[model samples]
Target chain A: MSATTAVPTTAGRRPMRGLGALTASEARLFLRDVGSVVFAVLFPALLVVGVGYALPGMRDPIEGMGAPWDGHLAIQLYIPIALSLAVATVALSTLPTQIVTARELGVLRRISTTPMRPQGVLIAQVVVNLGVLVLASLLALVAAALAFGLPAPQSPAVAALAFLVGAAATAGVGLLIAALVRKASAAGGIGMMVYFPMLFFAGMWTPGPLMPDTVAAIAQFTPLGALSQALTAAWFTGEFPALQLVVMVAYIVVLYPLAAKLFRWQ
Target chain B: MTTVVQVENLRKSYGAKVAVADVSFAVERGEIFGILGRNGAGKTTSVETLAGLRRADGGSVRVLGVDPRKDPQAIRTVVGVQLQEARLPARITVIEALHLFASFYPDPADPEELLGMLGLTEHRGKQFAKLSGGLKQRLSIALALVGNPQVAILDELTTGLDPQARREVWDLVERVRDSGVTIILVTHFMDEAERLCDRLVVIDEGRVVAAGSPAELIRGGNDERTFRMRLPDGAADQFDLIGSLADVHTVIAVEDEVEVTGSTHVLPAVILALAESGIVPDEIRTMTRTLEDVFVDVTGHAPEEELAA
Candidate 1:
């Protein structure tokens, strides 16, 4: 062999540089899964469109309520509930399953052999899932405003903040579930175990003013419930719901690093 | 030739499991080095240490003159590894996987060139789940070489592949070596080791049982002639003349096997003596000791005793 053909085994490239390509690759993979797309992105809009057209009572003004809550329609309240479902679906159902499946396939181990850290894959996962959650939220909001003659969110910035922190809080829980699972089946099973009950508290079955007073008081303590209340509070009141944001941030603070500590590479 | 990988007295264990009790080898630049052993042997553990996937409980490993334990991060840049049972996501396309892994290196081989070179160009758009075992292996090898490392470690490259696919992968390995990258191949298949390895260490039950080229191991120590034959049902007596020949040393007949051990020219002498008696043996296999026999001779067990893990 000539001197020009001599191999130069480097220590690897810049560590952070691989993240963009990694996220793009993961995004493409995520887009290929029909199950993830249907449940994460389309389901929330389906909830908005289906409920608006199917249940005419939802588009009418909510009755039997007085003061500031009087003018809001049942459909308006269902929109935030649908948004909660959006974040929960991807964060709980899609995120954990994807992570545990990659672990089962030894993707983490394979990535570790490169110059990039395995943590890059985790960061990419978070970024992709969070981006999907945001998209799902906006799709639900836009569908409600365009189809039902609902106005724009009273405070768009506050709504966005609620979406991010709310989605992150739920994603943190999904990471913890992924960290605890050894197989994709187990991830799906455990994610389901945590999913439906959380949705129950988030008022998927009971919109604002429709839920019992005691149930609403109880839902404030749960992650998705806090998210639902936060989004609802941001929309009608046009203010940052400080207590709801704190509750969501608390979940992120406690769950995310714990998931990282417990992450299983293979 | 220069030594790019040097390992000495490597030892690793999971609690009391003792996965690698004692192991060592040196790999020359631009040669395919084999770590030959059966499943449950220390072959995987030893390479895992060299690749910096595992820390040795004892001993030292240096890949490209850098110690893996002290600086595992440094080794990752210099050595590209295709780990046993390691796989890409099922939905990832072949081309996407190559491009994705290429992003991890400062200087990477062209993805298109790697695809064409590995015979995966047509399968570039195929999802990983849709590829055949051979195609998946080709993609795995492409990912390993994508980083343009000086050394590539491929563990169990053809474990689940068919014979034809196995041969194709072996040919690919040779071509890769021809490109000037040193390869460390870990496999349980004796034929794979003999066909591709320039030099190898035979690991058995977490220890080095033998070390040399396949030919050297077959030639064995002291260069003695040993041959085995199978005779007709009642032709055991035919060994009487061949045993007494001037060049012959010993003949042992047991069941269907008639084995002869002797000095030079003994094979031809025995054949000539057998021909004179109007005796024709059903089968005669001469002086050919494959890696299987070498393994048994050293480890006191067949190489296929354990399941392929």
Candidate 2:
């Protein structure tokens, strides 16, 4: 046997040193995935540009409500829907799938053996997904403004708050789904199953203004629907939708802890 | 040598099925200790408990003088583990995986040097999924050692590798052990245990059957040796005389060959008796009991048979 080498003692080193390095590495990996980039970062903007600019009548004002709601174009209503789509794409599809896949692959188990806990990897993943969602939503908003002359938000601060809360609620739902699913493929399948329906109720296929009263009333109860209403109200009327805010807050309060409780590190 | 890992009467169960029961062992520092068993034999459960990944249902486990159940984090800093069937992200490059794992430690080995030592320098740019089975195994070992941990628990370190690759990995493990990192290797291959392990415990059906060095275990169970040679022209008639010798246990003649099995002293005794019978034989070979023989003697079945069962 060869002589043993001298091992340096690690006396004064800190335990939580390289979480930023972990986050940076995870972000690089997230960008390397072409499918995630296309769906989470570019698809929402494409939806806005394709529907708002390519179709002529989509930019025309609807002929329903009296003065307050009159002269509102379908494209303007879609801007909030586009933002909600970005959040759902990232939170429901991208973030959960990534986390579930990491768990299935034993990546989380491998990290658990280290001095740093595996929760750091999960937090890094969430941070990267949230960053992507923000960029994607901004890109869609910018594209809408340039393509069809979409107006800026009436209250930028309230819109920003609504977006933040909406993102948190939707991401919590994603974590819940991730906690429930055991495999990456199942996470993807279940995410899409939940994503498209939530988007439908959020007025992706039919504008919220055009939905029947009964359907719109039911949509208000869904988390994404509440998010869309709050974002649209903030952008159009400059008023905070208190009920919508409460709905989103309720989703976050219930789902986040439930997901955490159900989460399996191995 | 000081004891680094101590497990006493450890017990665990999954629902109604017991995975491990009454398992106890201690590993000395700077030794390549082995836990040898078939699949589902609780070798992994025992090792995982030592690594603080699982909570034992009964008994006590102290890794590096710290109770794993009391403080898993304390062991985490000093122990590194490479779990069975665990993998890195498919899209992560080799260097990126190393760096990511390296960042988890307070004083990790240099990623570039570690990769070079593992013969992965040329494949640093390859994604994890793109690497071959041997390369993947090497990368896993590299990651396990990157933390500069005092103790490493490697589960099935060379399961799927080809013979040459397995040898290379064994060499790397020896070097790692030489660097004073105590290793607890979990494997079912008896040849691996015989070659690499200084001391080992045989776990069968969630219990330790025997524990000792390879030579000691073989001697403890069955010390019989066998010698075979081509039967000379007149030697077949005197087989009974050789079988009646003091050290000879059995003698049989089949076609052109005569086989003798007995104690270690039987070889020379059989040879002298055959010569006295005026027979000069060619093509003589001796077969000694190996760890595999010891394993079969203790477990009542071969490792492969257990795996198939």
Per-model DockQ: 0.45, 0.50
Worst 10 residues of 1 chain A by lDDT: A1-10
Off by over 4 Å in 1: A1-12, A152-158, A238-240, B228-240, B252-259, B268-285, B305-309
Worst 10 residues of 1 chain B by lDDT: B300-309
Tell me the alpha-carbon RMSD of every candidate. Answer: 3.3, 3.0
- Please provide, for model 1 over B213-261, each residue's C-alpha lDDT reduced to its tens digit, 9 standing for 90 to 100: 9999988774568788887766677766787898889999766788898
Summarize candidate 2's per-residue lDDT along B74-183 as a digit string, tens digits. 77877889888999888899999899888887778999998888999999999999998889999999999998888999999788788888899999999989988999
TM-score of 2: 0.95
Write one digit per residue (lDDT tens) for candidate 1, span A1-266.
Answer: 12212333343235566789999998999999988888888889999889888986877876768745677777888888998999899989988998898889899989988878888888898788878887887798788888876656778898888888988898889989999999999999999999998899899888866789899888887889999988887777676788889999999999989998998798
- Find the candidate with the highest DockQ and give its number: 2
TM per candidate: 0.92, 0.95
